[model samples]
Target: MQAWQAGAHPRSAPGLADLPFALGVASGTPSHQGVVLWTRLAVVDPLDPRVHTVRWELAEDEGFQRIVQRGQTETQQALGHAVHVELQGLPADRWFHYRFMVGDAVSPVGRTRTLPAPDSPAGRLRLAFASCQRWEHGYYAAWRHAAAQSLDLVVFLGDYIYEYASPRSGLAPQAATPIHRVHELRRAVSLADYRDRYALHKSDPDLQAAHAACPWLLTWDDHEVENDYAGLQGREGASAEFMAQRAAAYQAFYENMPLPASVLVQGLQGLNQADALRLYQRHAFGRLARFHVLDDRQYRAVQACRNPSESSAGTVRPSRCAELRDPSRSLLGAAQEQWLAQGLAQDSRPGGPRWTVLAQQTLFSPRHYGGASAAAQADEPTPTDPWDGYPGARQRLLHSLQATPPRNTVLIGGDIHQNYVCRVHADPDRPDSPVLASEFCGTSISSHSGATLERAQALQKNNPHVLLANPEQRGYALVELNPQRWQTTLMAVDQPGRADSALRPLARFVVEDGRAGPQRES
Candidate 1:
């Protein structure tokens, strides 16, 4: 065991005052055996190849008197000076506090916990899932409020950082609240640009607090690289240059996040992130809930019926786009589709989890829009960016699901920048389609929905399975999973630009045991 004063500075190194741990420390991807600890070394010359030593300590109590784990690790410049310490053999289902030290300065103390032993009977699990946090739109008050809650884990669905240039440059939604601040650099292209972007976003105190509060299981969406990228194909079209940019972005993403080393690997071509991390993996919280994290960005074909630069990319009339219904298109790709099918079958067995959570970016349930009349909607097509665009892929999973349909499967999603609670049927349009799943789509933490509130609310009428929809609010969802039932309360922030905003619960939905859908609690 190492002994030293909690805040003692044995040696003061140069450039340390510039904030060595500028991005802060975090922990995540925890299991019954252990958890991963993360931190980035911010220096004047970020690309320096010299290795820097960082000391870390974990304890049962907030103070150092109860130190449980202590060690020192060196972060080489080649990996962007990011340290990911995978600590194993820790006791399960217990809270732990950790901090990092360089010279005398210390990083904020973070709290994290490992899951209960797999298959062990669980009592209650508090999980808060959110996504789509555009840096320029609003303050991260949502994160500040969420940190104060009693949460076991935080699942960030995607869009951890937007790759586009700052909204102040007039690229953001026009109706959004005025920018509270600006980003560090232009659209992220090189590795340095991406690293600076992550640093800019992490600089937020509220976001830092949220990471320090608990561990997070994260996946990416379009904005992390670029909006609506399809595999190697970018919005501008696929090319060697674009792939190189993607490689840099992927490496930068892995450097900033608390993902395990299993997710980061260099292939013959370059960094193959999707292949390495195997994002479509499952985790069980004892017997209470099973979280299946998905990557909707990789392996999917390009958006059909519309181009990226078009103004109406997200909306189109079905009659005008025959290719939208092509049977060859896919969203989750082929291999993941098969993997999910097997997982669903295994989970549907007689003794399965009480709740199966499908955590991913973008919406799953279909949404049609055109006019007030069903005939008018029949004239329109749903956005291709979400499952609505890939009916064939959606049908494939829905078919497999309708066959066995995992126990109490509940879909939690972000992106679309709105809150929606709906029932998922094999065919969203059919009057008598069997409801196979339940979906709870939370709004963005700060990103604005370009559509007006009335336009978003009007969607509820076009889609009957929708019990509730709100586009005006900005915040996240609070979900509690137990053996008996699962409850999700939609929490919204009244002021998106205000850092001191409170998270007021807008609505609550409950999924009963053995039921296939969620019902309005009120």
Candidate 2:
């Protein structure tokens, strides 16, 4: 923690106008002991250079009559006046209410909870996972619904904010409903641009309510920095300018999110050195579940056989591109892959977590988007941005799962703006291969998908492993886990453009203990 000095506060400074907490508050990265509390001081001028002291208090009750913890922290213009208070040595598996104060202004009270003790026999865990919430596409109705779910944790898969200039700038056409909002900048490139963009997204009341509901565990996808970005490379390829832009985006992301101070320090050091941010992490919910939150965009190799003419992912037949099958290519990079394998192996051991949850970005199962049959589609032109493009890396991940005991494993992901529920086979190419795990790839919160319901239904015949595919709806996945079984409810909002839209369960499935495929429950 950085030492704070007693100085003239923003409220006391002349000519400086005090503002309410427009960006709101959030908490995340929970452990048995404590969690990371976050808030950014809303100022009249974001570029105000004076360091301001922000005070916070945590209590067992919402009224905060009996405050248990109280402290003060300093924020400055360098970090967008954001404060990350990582508290430790607190009781485990308990709810706490916290709020930040600057002079007479008090931030909204946020509710957060710590994870169960590592050795405790936790009975159940309720979580909701979502992704791809393009602010322009629709209202945050899904988030509002999620806020009412009373989830213990919210696993955000990615694309919390899109980098597109406008709805028209996206690759696909807008949904039937018109865009409800627009981005502040044409495109977020500089630190100020990214900061303003984050501020815009954070201003959503529904999103703020969701953040205040519980602690969030997040791992971002491409749009957080740039669409289809891989490692240090962007859509137009790598350059000094792109690297600097990436650094700014990363810094802004760290400042806005409810992440630990350690991540901020490491991210800054990495930005200065390698233009990267270490985001992949593991969290345990007692011995009931272990979440392996993965970062797929930061260290992945550039998409295979990328077309020089296009500014995004390329589609090519596997037979024509040998690079697509190259074993040297990786999505999680060598180090993260190794770390994942080790964690999965350990979690599969006796006395380890009963359920191993691999929370990542994008669909994991193989899907055929073209050709008449699955066999023919295997050779047809396929997008080089997903798991299909990195067959070798996907195979390695399967091998890692195979090496572990037959524990209850669930793979949850987002991206592609579609809901995909499938049985992850040991080898997707082999129809007779053994089922290794169950997967639930959630639909985007609001991002539009080009594939219609009819098209998604038609593709299911070619992809037998898929149990459910709904591309038209826009919502999230609610997961409930216990020792006996794991349940996932596909929750969709009736209208993405309407703020008061009602949410309904599109589908529900369950995976029994020792089973690897999802069975339709309703």
Error of 1 at 146 (Å): 0.2
**What are the TM-scores, per candidate, against the unseen true structure?**
0.92, 0.94
> In model 1, which runs have C-alpha deviations exceeding 4 angstroms?
1-12, 15-17, 168-177, 234-238, 265-269, 272-277, 306-313, 371-374
Query: lDDT tens string, model 2, 25-84?
Result: 999999999999999876666676888788999999999998989999988788988999
Best by TM-score: 2
lDDT of 1 by residue, 407-494 (tens): 7889999988999999988777773688888999999999888767787777887778888878888899999878888899999998
- lDDT: which candidate is best? 2
Worst 10 residues of 2 by lDDT: 1-10
- Cα lDDT of candidate 1 equals 0.81
